[model samples]
Target: MGTVYQINKGLNRPISFKGLKAQYIAYLSAGLVVLLLGFTVGYILGLPLVVLLPATGLLGGGLFVGVNFLSKRFGRYGLMKYLASRRVPVYLWFNSRKLFTQLKIGEGYGKK
Candidate 1:
């Protein structure tokens, strides 16, 4: 229903935000959006702005910093490789194959 599979989807994109490229911008944006949403919800619920804002700010800022750290440590492609390496290897490449069978009465390989 919604992009159930992706084949060869990885692309090394350029810096789109203040030298942040590829997944870095996405991580930063997601962290900021989360912070904004949390702040908005606290405001709508009439929570004490003094306490709520700082708490949410710390949470969001932590997320942003953590993501930024990972991005710098792994870069675009290395991070992908690191994540992918965690998964089980489901494929092994091999070469050469043949199917052989003796013909029977009124039967052939393709006929059946």
Candidate 2:
């Protein structure tokens, strides 16, 4: 038999599943797990299957849709970048230029 090598088309690429990408896959999985636990807890607490079933189904549907939407809307790293950008202030508030004026070019910190 001749040697056959399988090619890895997804090498160095973000993990994707059924239209969800990267961290969004984790998000969807976590959400589903939470839903599953909630369903189990409710069922153990004597809640009606009628109520638990529909609630779990609706929340699971929402989780899938939301995660897929975020993956498409934000790409792989866009969501993280967007979240990081939100931490930045819109404008820097400076009362004086003393902080900038004290900087000596090419000088390391604490060097007199």
Candidate 3:
């Protein structure tokens, strides 16, 4: 059996399902925004839409890679701190205590 927990931020408590849905929606919105901006810029510059497509693809790919690299380098604590400060709800598979314990063990053994 799995348990779900609600994430609270100050006076606002967004339902966990809502937060998850919002995150996906945000990603979709970002992609759409990028595409629209690229199209607009390309039109203004008299560039072919085909060229803009590749440029947008490259930019989005690079951004995704960079974000992943940074997140990997920073680890969970860094990500948690960042999310908490930004008032974003973080959903985890386990409770904080178990998560921290696993993190410590993994860090200790995995370090070179």
Candidate 4:
């Protein structure tokens, strides 16, 4: 017999965009799209090219660089891990399974 195989083997393929590996492609593409949309919307809104060009350039550049830096500093899984680590907690509780230790519809956690 050969090596064991997973049932969801298709999911194991590395995520990529264009020829670039990992999330770089996604970041670049999204940045470019934002750049284009910024210009288009600015033009339609009658903003001057002088201001629009620089503003869009900075916006797009910042997004592109930010994304690239994030991806590089944190590998595929690391990026999500980084984000999760910084997220605020939704559930806060002590030891007891008292009256308000569960999730509520519109009320704050641990509060009535």
Candidate 5:
């Protein structure tokens, strides 16, 4: 889960993410290891040309997907709010408790 934020109406929303921090860090670390292996193999095999480009491209593509997934999952709250705001029924859930309590309190005060 990503950070939770309260909207202006005081309702909490949760953010989701694809990979956790540690897993992401570990994935990058493994990519670095693969990159180093690619470089070393190229150096030892004297094939200076062919392998490096493909290796880098593969590693880069993996990182791109990982980052994109993370952002989309974690950044969804604004979208959720937009969806909720567009529907009156959705917004009412957030306000119903407060509205009911206020009404009850007003009725009691008036009775006194």
Candidate 6:
């Protein structure tokens, strides 16, 4: 007998795992990978296991906490929207009106 697994049928829903949603999962995974690489490099370079172990453990714990916090605070797409909002300028400082004036209905600049 073969085992059957239930598939997700939600339409356009963000992927989530263990309360971590969408990009937060990726963030946590990447952080863990970086910590693993750092630990490996430190070990190869002869750094004591005591130091590497504690440091890696602390970093991994921090990564999990931070990612979980972000996931909870900013729903699925809120984080991306927040980041995009930061890129918007507070005020537009146009030096001159020439740029706007040159724009005409159905015509290019300096063209008949």
The number of the candidate with the highest lDDT is 6
Candidate 1, position 94, lDDT = 28
Top TM-score model: 6
Tens digit per residue, CA lDDT, model 6, 1-112: 9999889869899998999999899998889899999999999999999899999999889889999999999989999999987887868646689988887786765567
Rank by TM-score, descending? 6, 2, 1, 4, 3, 5
lDDT of 6 at 38: 96
- Can you give the TM-score per candidate against the true fold? 0.60, 0.75, 0.37, 0.55, 0.35, 0.77
Q: lDDT scores for all predictions?
A: 0.74, 0.89, 0.60, 0.74, 0.61, 0.90
TM-score (C-alpha, index-matched) for candidate 4: 0.55
lDDT by residue (2-112, candidate 5, tens digit) is 999865653463322344332444555676787778777887788755767787778778876775565455453444565567786744557447667667555857586
Residue 66's lDDT within candidate 3 is 55
What digit string (tens of lDDT, one per residue) describes model 2 on residues 14-107? 8777888899989988999999999999999999999999999999999888888899999999999999877878687467899888978866
lDDT comparison, 3 vs 4, better candidate: 4
Off by over 4 Å in 1: 1-13, 89-112
Worst 10 residues of 1 by lDDT: 92-101
* Candidate 5 deviant stretches above 4 angstroms: 1-20, 67-112
Clashing pairs in 1: none
Q: Per-residue lDDT tens digits of candidate 4, residues 25-106?
A: 7778877987898799989999999999999889887976677677667766787777776684757534567656674676
- Candidate 1 per-residue lDDT over residues 29-61, each given as its tens digit: 887887888888988999998989789978977
Q: Candidate 4: list runs displaced more than 4 Å.
A: 1-21, 87-112
lDDT of 3 at 73: 55
Q: Give the Cα error of residue 72 in candidate 6, in Å.
A: 0.5
Better of 1 and 6 by lDDT: 6
Clashes of each: 0, 0, 0, 0, 0, 0
- Checking candidate 6 for backbone clashes, the offending pairs are none
